[model samples]
Target: MKLAIVGGGSTYTPELIDGFARLRDILPIGEIALIDPAEQRLELIAGLARRILARQGSPARVTTSTSVTSGVDGADAVLLQLRIGGQSARHRDETWPLECGCVGQETVGAGGLAKALRTVPVVLDIAEQVRASNPAAWLIDFTNPVGIVTRALQDAGHRAIGLCNVAIGFQRKFAAHLGVEPERIRLEHVGLNHLTWERGVTLLDEPDGESGREVLPELLDRFGERVAQDVRMPLTLLESLGVVPSYYLRYYYQHDAVVRELGARPSRAEEVAALERQLLALYANPSLNTKPELLAQRGGAFYSEAAVQLIAALLGTDGRSRTQVVTTRNDGILPQLPDAAVIEAPATVDAKGVRPLPQRPLPPLFAGLVAHVASYEELAVRAAVAGGRARVFDALLAHPLIGQLDLADQLTDRLIAHNHGYLSWA
Candidate 1:
């Protein structure tokens, strides 16, 4: 199979390459096209990718391209992982929001909205090119604000599926804590991307047929504190909610405190910017054939495994359906949101297509939050596709984090000002 990775210049590319090398038996990759405009960084990443494959004795042909059309041509699958305006833009996304007393996170709140506006247009353009090259090829999005991006792709009539590592990361953690294989632990992962909760932990040796021992209570009883620490939530809150919220929930459940903490520290974007520089230096070393340990701290843990599993199932390489967390159309999965709304939930994926499984009614607590965010996402997507200051302000006003008019107005101006170069309407 031929696979193309857009933004192959990113420091995160080697981790993906390592997964491709190790999982060749499951998903035999015959060729790799690394596409990036930054020719220097692209060469560094492609060199390490070739060396990693060579070390594994894999015969996959590695190629490089500075154009999306050339890189994705005739490829069976195209993976989108590009950043429109690199980490410097991310620094702005993470810091500017704190000035208005809001969470400065890239995947949630004001920062997430900024990323969606900047990313959606670029991703849509690339998707159009990928479709033009080979309409049959599947587009896998591993981008930020995945809910919005995936929604835009499906809206544009593109064959796309959104992937995130959060579910896999949770699965691995719960598996290690329970002394089971990660595959055996199926998460009852529900909600939108980056805004999900683990309501049930089912142990199933086979595919999720909606039948398994629900061990969430037991897992909490035995290892609640550790789980709380991992998610940065208080153990008492976990007991009260009777569910595990994504770590991103910290931004919502404790918005003011998070804003204070964000204001005090150098933004995460700053830390990652420095780390990427160091990682690029390492990638440039000809002797380096493996992903460095520091890459682990750079985040996106288990992303490669998640991407491989999703691709394998989608391409029928696994020869059977598998349940995995993905961002796809709601399709009435939750009665609270519109079917067109994109949500991150576990679904059965196979060659035929992805179908969201039926979900139990979300408790009022979770449902309210999910519905609120889903509404904001719809508006945010509209603003992203058809830009306007009023649209931006409306989306911000609808967000639970910035529902006040004054704050929304201020954030909208700042978002537009910081993102004017990318926003065509600005």
Candidate 2:
């Protein structure tokens, strides 16, 4: 199989290379094309990718390119990981929203809407090129504002699926606490992209074998402190909700506190920018083939595994009806949201494509929030595709985080002014 990574120059590429080398048996990739406009970074990362493959004694050949058309041509799967304006733009997204007293996140609040407006057009253009190159090739998106981006691609009639590592990260953590392999844990993760919860964690491959022994409560009881700390939520909240919220939920569950906290610390984008510099220097080392430990700090934990597994399943290399969490169009999976909205949930993946598993209706508390966010996502997509200040304002107004008309107006103006270059239609 030939796989192309769009943002192959990113510091996170090495972690993906490591996964490809280690999990070769699962996907058996024959070639990898690293596609990026940053030639120097791409060359450095490509060298490391080759070295890692060689050290693992894998026959997969690694290549680098600045042309998406040439790089993705004939590839079996194309992975989207590009950031529209890099971390510098992300810093703006993270910092500017706080000025409006809204959560300064890249994929949730006004900032996320800003990112979507900047990102969707570029992603669609790339998807068009991929289709022209290889109509059969699957598009695996790991881009931010995934729920919105994925919906755009699907609506445009592209074969695409969005991926996030949150569920896998949770699974790994839960597995460790249960003293079991990660594969044995099955998470009933449900919601739209960043707004999700692990309602149930069943032991799938264990002796109990699909008996549906939910371990979420046990995990909360035994490892509540650790989990709570990681998510930055009060343990009591978990006890009260009876479900573990995704770390992204912190911006919502504790909005005022998060605003205060964000005001006090440097934005996450700043920290990642510094870390990326260190990672690039390490990648330039000729002797360094294995991924540096610092790469873990770069985030997207287990991303490579999720991508490989999903790609394998999509191509029918893995015949098992693997229940994996992914973002795809909602075809009545939620029953509460529009069928066109993209949602993140556990789905059975195979050669036919992803099929979202039936889920119990979300409780009113969670349903209301999911529906509210889904409305924002819908408007965000429209605003992104059909660029107009009014569309942008309406989307912001619909967002639960920025419902006030005046605040919505402020956010819309800031978003357009900051991202005007990327919004050609505006």
Candidate 3:
């Protein structure tokens, strides 16, 4: 099989390459195309990718390309990981929202909306090209604002599924705490990308199946403090909810505190920019044939394993339907959400397609927030696909984080101003 990674120039690419090398038996690839406009970075990543593959004695050929059309041509799967405006733009995304007293996160609030507007159009265009080149190819999106981007892809009728590392990261962490293998812990993870919760932890053998032994309560009881620290939430809150919320929830559950925290520190974008410099320097080392330890701090922890597992299951190479947390069409899995809404939930993936598994009803505490965010996401996709200042405002106003008309108005202006260069309709 042939695979192509758009934005393969990213510092995160090496982590992915390392996974492919280690898990080749699960998802064999005859070739890999690293697509990016940053030719120098592409060369550096591609060189390291080749070395990583060689160290494993795998014959998967690594190639670099500056053109998405050519890079994805005839590829079995196309992975989208590109950043539209790079970290400099991310710095803006993570900074400007604070001025409005909102959490300035890359995948939440006004900043996330800005990223959606900038990313959706490009992703759609690339999807179209992929369709032209290989209609059967799976477009795996690892892009931010995943719910919005994946909605756009599916809306356009492209074969796409969105992947994020949060669910897998949690699974691994929970498994370690339980002194069990990661595969034995099946997370009852629900909600949209980044905004999800672990409702249960079932110790099971298969990736997707009936609940084995319900162990979430026990795990929470024993390791509540550790889990709380991982999610950056208070143990009291965890005790109240009976579920572990993603760290992103902190932006909502404690918006004012997050705003103050962000204001007091450098934007995460700035920190990542510095880390990328160090990572690139490491990548430049000819002797370096493996992903560096510093790359782990660069974030996207367990990304490689998640990607490999999902791709393997998607391609039917895993030899059975696999349940993995992915962002895909709702398809009635969550009655609270429309079928067309893209949600991050556990789904059975196979060569035929992805099917969201049945889920218990979410109580008002979770469902209300899910519905509210789903509404905002709908408007967010609209503002992204068919641009207008009013649409952007409506989406922001709909967001729980920016419900006030005045704040939404201010944020809309700031978003367009900061991202006008990337938004054609601005």
Candidate 4:
């Protein structure tokens, strides 16, 4: 069996590669290929992967190419973790739209839509290749605007899964609140990526209804303010529904009433600047190329796939055990909505491949928001690929925040004029 990691030379690639190398023993199978256009990044990462494999007492064949098709053909799986602007370009993508008075945040609002228009085609093209070349390969997505991109790929009939560290990562953060280890927790993650909240977690056998009755009440009463105070957490989903969540809680907190009541806001300007400075510094680091050991210390040397451990679970490596993933539609897994809804839900993994979790209805607000954004993203994908400004305008207007503002037409025009070549139809 073979695995292909498209955009294999990214900063995060080393992490994924290292993660995969770490899990390779359980997997104990075949070659892992890296697909990337930049020879420099690919060479550096390949060197590192071999070194990692050697250290792990295993010899994993590492190969790469500039061509997407060559990298993906006949591969058993493709794990995608692509960035549109690379590290440096993200600053402009994040800051420019905010400067224009658009939602200004990354991966959710105006900025996300703009980024989506630029990315959909590349992702779509690659998906088409993967489907045609190796129809059985699972497409694991770690792409941003994940809900939007994942939805589009499935609508076009590609085999794919969206992975967010959010589910596990969030579980860990909130575990701090509950006083437990994340690995020991079992939870149901619902809603869109990045926006997802834990509807439920069972730890120490915290019976569903029991924890629902006890822990949430305690969280809301005791540490609710503490959780919301960070400005990176999204406690609104928790408070609105009375369940705790993980990942990026602070920003969501600002979006919620609790923050307003407390007169709190995440320092957006400062936050954006700090992120920009960090990314800039990362690009400027010289040891990034010549010194693998030192660069490894920086944590960028671990080129990796999105779900090696999960893949190990599917392959049943080292008894890692299978898991349930909430992603895309295969059948009537979700009862009410079209299998086409691209709803996130629990799934099972095995040596054969990754399969969808049977779907359940999300909370009304969460469902509606995910549906609306996904629908508009599809519309925007069509517009971007076909060069239709009106459709693009309508797509932007259809977004929750943009739709609410009534500035779609003007904002559309301004952004089109400003972004120019960047937004095709605009």
Cα deviation of 115, candidate 4, in Å: 1.4
- Each prediction's whole-model lDDT (CA): 0.92, 0.91, 0.92, 0.62
Off by over 4 Å in 4: 174-181, 204-226, 229-240, 245-306, 313-321, 330-337, 351-367, 404-406, 417-426
Between 3 and 4, whose lDDT is larger?
Answer: 3
Model 1 spans > 4 angstroms off? 205-211
Q: Please give, for residues 1-426, the per-residue lDDT of candidate 3 as tens digits.
A: 999999999999989989998999999999999999999989999999999999988889999999999999989899999799999999999999999898898899999999999999999999999999899999999999888999999999999999999999999999899888888889899999888999988988554446579898898899999999999999999989999999999989999988999999999999999999999999999999988999989899988899998889888886877888999999898998899999999888888889888999999999999999999999999999999999999999999998998999999999999999998888
Lowest-lDDT window of 10 residues in candidate 1? Answer: 203-212
Model 2 collision count: 0
Kindly report which residue stretches of model 3 are placed more than 4 angstroms away from their true locations once superposed. 205-211
Q: Model 1: per-residue lDDT, tens digit, 85-176?
A: 88999999999998899899887989999999999989999999998889999999998888899999998999999999889999999989
Please give the TM-score that candidate 4 achieves against the real structure: 0.78
